[model samples]
Target: MKEQLIEKFENDMKKRSYFLRLLLVIDQFFNVLFWNGSQDETISSHVGRRIKSGKANRFEKLLCKFLSKLESEHCKKSLGE
Candidate 1:
């Protein structure tokens, strides 16, 4: 029973480690492809349209704010400068 428990724990740990590595690779890929400060054209258009509509829903304003914030943070992190 003790051996079985140890084996199970080891297997679980290996699985967790594999998951972490996979996640890291995914993150790195995204960071390279869409690093911080990158503005998505669709977001720009939507935000512009909402602002110009003179009738933005609360959610639109919130989304703009969120995107602006994300852009700023990403801009600082991106090596583009």
Candidate 2:
């Protein structure tokens, strides 16, 4: 399930406009610094850590938004909401 969510997030991000994609790359750079980590880290780990720490930056927030939206939609479909 986690892998599926991550895959969906990646696909959604790819569908974003070029400008937004550029901004996301910049955000990712800063987030890497804020995380005091390397750029090699996967976004999923970064977002998971930010969610735990309650210090999500723009990129992390965007990821959280995407995940929440997906989960809620999944729930609604399952429950016929």
Each prediction's whole-model lDDT (CA): 0.53, 0.61
Q: On residues 1-81, what C-alpha lDDT tens digit does candidate 2 reach at each position?
A: 999999988897778987977765675676577766556443555666656677767776676667667675331232210
The alpha-carbon lDDT assigned to residue 60 of candidate 1 equals 55
Question: What's model 2's TM-score?
Answer: 0.35
Best-fitting candidate, scored by TM-score:
2
lDDT of the structure predicted as candidate 2: 0.61
Give the candidate number with the greatest lDDT. 2
Alpha carbon lDDT at 56, candidate 1: 59
Candidate 1 C-alpha error for residue 30, in Å:
20
Cand. 1 Cα-lDDT: 0.53
In the order shown, what is each candidate's alpha-carbon RMSD? 15.0, 10.4
Error of 2 at 54 (Å): 8.1
